[model samples]
Target chain A: MTLDISAIRKEFPILKTSIGKYPLIYFDNGATAQKPQAVIDCINQYYQAENANIHRGVHHLSQLATEKYEAARGVIKSYINAAHDYEVIFTKGTTDGINLVAQSFGKLLQPGDEILISQMEHHSNIVPWQMIAEERGLQLRYIPINERGELDLTTIDELINNNTKIVAITHISNALGTINPIEEIIEKSHKVGAKVLIDAAQSLQHTTVDVQKIDCDFLVFSGHKIFGPTGVGILYGKEDVLNQMPPYQGGGDMIKTVTLEKTTYNNLPHKFEAGTPNIVGGIGLGKAIEWLSQFDLEAIAQYEQELLDYATEKLLKIEGLKIFGTSAKKCATISFLIDNTHPYDVGTLLNQQGIAVRTGHHCTQPIMDFYKIPGTIRASFSFYNTKEEIDLFIGALNKAVMMLK
Target chain B: MTITEKEQGLIDSFSIYDDWMDKYEYIIELGKDLPLISEDQKTDENIIKGCQSTVWLAAEKREDKIIFTADADAIIAKGIIAILIEVMSNESPDTIINAKLDFLKEIGLQEHLSPTRSNGLVAMVKQMKMYALALKMK
Candidate 1:
């Protein structure tokens, strides 16, 4: 591998930690990634020297914090290649971003307009649209997936028709690791004059995502999933669309002037940001993205793909083991179930060997229902992971299967 | 044996295995031997939905003692329920309600009993005690 795997693992402090008796082999990057010392130190340094409220204070600390926080927004703008800095709004996480769009931009939809999502969407993406559809008297539809867990785009023309208002889809499936054909989806959605929102919660960490290039109207992702702290995220929208939509929350920072009878909303990003936000989370998210930028994302993507291939090969060797996602394009995640064995039993056994994996429907119950299984044991890898760790995981998985069987 | 005596016996039995895999193997064996609930009793009302697994529990009062039969989709959960049934079944209502079940920790099965694990063991235990309290009132 071109990337030094040993040096990369050293950057994460939790890699050195022991779970019970064994050293931690964290294969749960899909759930949340471990933070590097750089991100951790940046957070600590912020709290130590420059912790203050932003945008409202005129003091020295406030201005410094504001400058840093705004600069962080600029970093995110460039990272996603958004046209304007003000188009990047700070959010709680991906869920919050979707809800913001559903609540605010959703107001523009009339009765009988359709919101098309996918069968592979996480619950966050599904539920918000459902709620908004019910409220606005809009029809909700889903794009189905094939047995390979890839989206079945044959019905795209019928799905994204003239009545379709917005199409919200994940750039990658969190449970199945299917990197979706987002560009194609966006092109089709826009052809029918429908706005598109890309949920990049799983894709942002693994590959490079450019909103401008994709021409998606909106994109959202979480900070913690990208080696940063939790509770902070980004919502990028085209400036014209964001200016057209109403504010999601009405509070101190979101309004330009306040009268009991009538109030005007603030500008683009500030209009959506209402309260005292996660300042530290925002700064840390910026640092996390900066830390990630040091390494070429294309290189990380290649390394992670290699790990996925190696793990998939070793896992398929086990008799009765079936992987859920087998798309030609995939990320470094494998969700599998052994013959007649419950995922929880195998996951628990793997945990005994200190191999951390996610076991459940992964908030994508439709995918599980489509596969006719309750859940699958998912092992997701990162760049820091090595082939040796994959060997250990394979050994542990074999023992788990043997014991369960 | 009384509940406490049965717990001590289980702890003694588990003490024989020094390795983690050995301990899990024994649990798997116990899972194979779990006192399964009747197929008719495996209804919606009896199902406890944990985040990771599904558990079905049935409790009946037989001659002033509570008889518990439980099943879980997951083998580890089934094994844990087997341990619980071994200790808590065929015990007096007052005894079943008051049992602390500390031996689970001593046997390293305590992690399964955690509310986070939610394999339905905790909920099943609480439901068992609730049945006991209801039967006593009756």
Candidate 2:
């Protein structure tokens, strides 16, 4: 069950490109993953063979289109192990999904209700709630994280109290790579009768998610992070909860019957989905899920964990490189800043040698604020990534540091 | 051609880090060839606010096309203005509208500019396009 990385590498065509006469070593999986050939071909096949509007027509192409679209939904249902396909709503991506919940569910909250979020959420998760809290008079609270980027869950009992209505948190930290105790967070929120929303953008790629098993009221993730096309994602909400909430956008497909008198909305998932959905993207996502299904999850996890351990040990040996988020339960992401070298300069120098690592606040500005530094160069990994790539990256980084000095 | 041989030579020397202070002396040397904006044309309406460096852009119609004249307080900003003028000047409304402006990427300038500076650059480009669009409407 060990991942055949060489075989996997062959599936991605972009890896062939060289930078500065060196082969490209992409360690920026936290931002987005490189798509496999199957996913790319699926997208291409849809455009080539089955280009038609879905769900509204009874013609042959449209019927085929609708069947394929719904089939993708079924794939997603099993991918996340949702109770039913009805729970999975297609979205633009994680940002749109979070915004939908915030706008629709946030409308129901009154002045005294509280919404709790973690300090490590990406701006995508934080800003939507901030907007909702401002519009409605609800108080927004934060579950603080320790120096290691692990949540201080001891205070969770006090944080989720009578007034708490919704608890939204990231399943995995994009900046620090700390995998939050989302199942425990969900349990605590449910105890207070609060619905929970998990941002599974980072976690969905590295780990398996079962929405029914986690019992989270809502879970969202983007497809691009999991080797699918961009501009498509899944928002899985319990059927009852989705039925209760109002429509997020008013447009073409999210309607049953419309009149000037009154407009009746479509069913649970469709109500949230408006306009022309990324039909081609949905097909690509289904192909990506199929690609991932070929591998054993346990094997993937073990290999990734070993890679992380190896990377951590090697990266720490380098002088003046301070690794952030030394938590025990972290994904294969390492964020570190070199002594006296600005992250941008390091990133530029690394790029010259074909080592692509992300260098910035990583859209978690508050985390940067807590550390009192501008940013760090983050190297995130996938199961397909090998130790040799890490060695190349490390060597380039060391050379970058020496050259900068 | 309104541009002097020296100005054309400066535009030819445009590089990615040409905006850096040390590199920008070459741009001020280029600005010496530019026709200064008439004092009467330097009105509030022509001013581009919120830039770190002051920039003024003015437009005139010639042969049913918009001709843009620009000046900036910073030498590099003036170089940016020069770059914009090179791409956009003397072009017809439809031609200006159709141009892809992919040279920004080719020169590797897009990634180096801060978000604010990029936005300012975008605003300048957008303003020039707006002039073309206005001409087309008339």
Candidate 3:
């Protein structure tokens, strides 16, 4: 099965818009995917017709809004193939989800216990654990990545010992585009009774993510990264695991009873969801997922792989250009640098040509330090992107290099 | 030239290039031609750290006029610094501080000079004024 590239491109209205004199060639999907018209309409309609505070109001709008929001949760639960709908918790984004686990689940760890993360894990995944470790007198360790940006699994035996409490790793490297061997990592970590958290912020849009099949203890992803609205994301944990942890935040909807002295928390998911949620954002995300469910994800992944290969070959032909993250098993993201040129310079010139790409350390400073480079210019592709856009990107990049050099 | 005259000179010079790339070509050349700050001056104290790029600025006053020297690791940032120096360097403390540098917008380079760019140009401009004020007070 093949994806209709043109049809997919048409669904995203922003793709047709121009930036200044040139048409916007968006290659920053790894940062945030452009929204489809369906998702946008869903948000507008929610506010226009069904605006109400959810879970408490006795009004008709509140009941309708609550139904839609919970329905969204069900969609996400099935999307990730979780065991139960109540296991899916809404968050501000991936960063919020990680911090929730670090704060709530960190209570379960004893002093001198260990938390394992990778060198390529985003700062969101690393800093929360570091904070918890520092507060708890726990040891924080890292799994190293080799020259190809693939995790060095040779040391996994020593790393995942009995003291290891949790292994938090990214399913895909946002900077390097390396698809991690997470299934193997999960198996190894669980052998010693350590739970695993998969940062799937970059995976849900590009590949299939199944929580039950992987049997991950916790999985997190942002709604905006998957063509949904911002300010909403999912934290999928096993029902048993989430039940073991305490409620993350305290406020309106997450409680069964509240008193001046003591309070009993609500059930599985609502216990974590505190305060008035982003009601419209959740419904928009549901629409976005429903819109995506029509397409064959496997076919989309295959098409993006071809695009990555084509761009890599063309980019390598340019002299003095070095591509980072050469992992054979990777996504359609590309990070590179030309000679001694700074990424900011190249990125600036590309912007002038209306080619949107990300520059700088990409919030993975440890990975940048590992590569011994300040930063790299990252051009991340999506399913709607094409070879013609890659050609334009290559031309713009050549011009940027010429001007900078 | 007076600061206003210098700004006008830049505006006039940039007006010839209708294309953004051509304007950047001129800016890159100016960046290359910017007077180098002494290696000793490129210390942590002199550095304005931007998330994407770093800029080192040093200044001293001779008579009533202050001379500013700056450099950046990224050429685009350096180019912006060069444009700023062209207007603010060798000017009195009050003139340097009060200068609007509106020529940046007039030349269609305001986006590059925004505080959010985080390339240190914004902080460098403020530091340049601080150096002038300090020298004037002394």
lDDT of 3 by residue, A272-338 (tens): 9989999999999989998888999999899999999999999999999999999999999999999
State the C-alpha lDDT per candidate: 0.92, 0.83, 0.92
Predicted candidate 2 versus true structure: per-residue lDDT over A121-180, tens digit per residue: 999999999999999999999998889988988888999999999999999999999988
Give candidate 1's whole-model lDDT: 0.92
Task: Give the higher-DockQ candidate: 2 or 3.
Answer: 3
Docking class of 3: high
What value does the lDDT take at residue A363 in candidate 2? 90
The CA-based lDDT of model 2 is what? 0.83
What's the TM for model 1?
0.98
Docking class of 2: incorrect
Q: What are the clashing pairs of model 2?
A: none
Q: Which segments of candidate 1 are over 4 A away from where they belong?
A: none
**Tens digits of lDDT, candidate 3, B1-138:** 788889899999999999989999999989987877999999988887563787888888889888888888989888888888888888999998788888888999877677887656677778887888898897
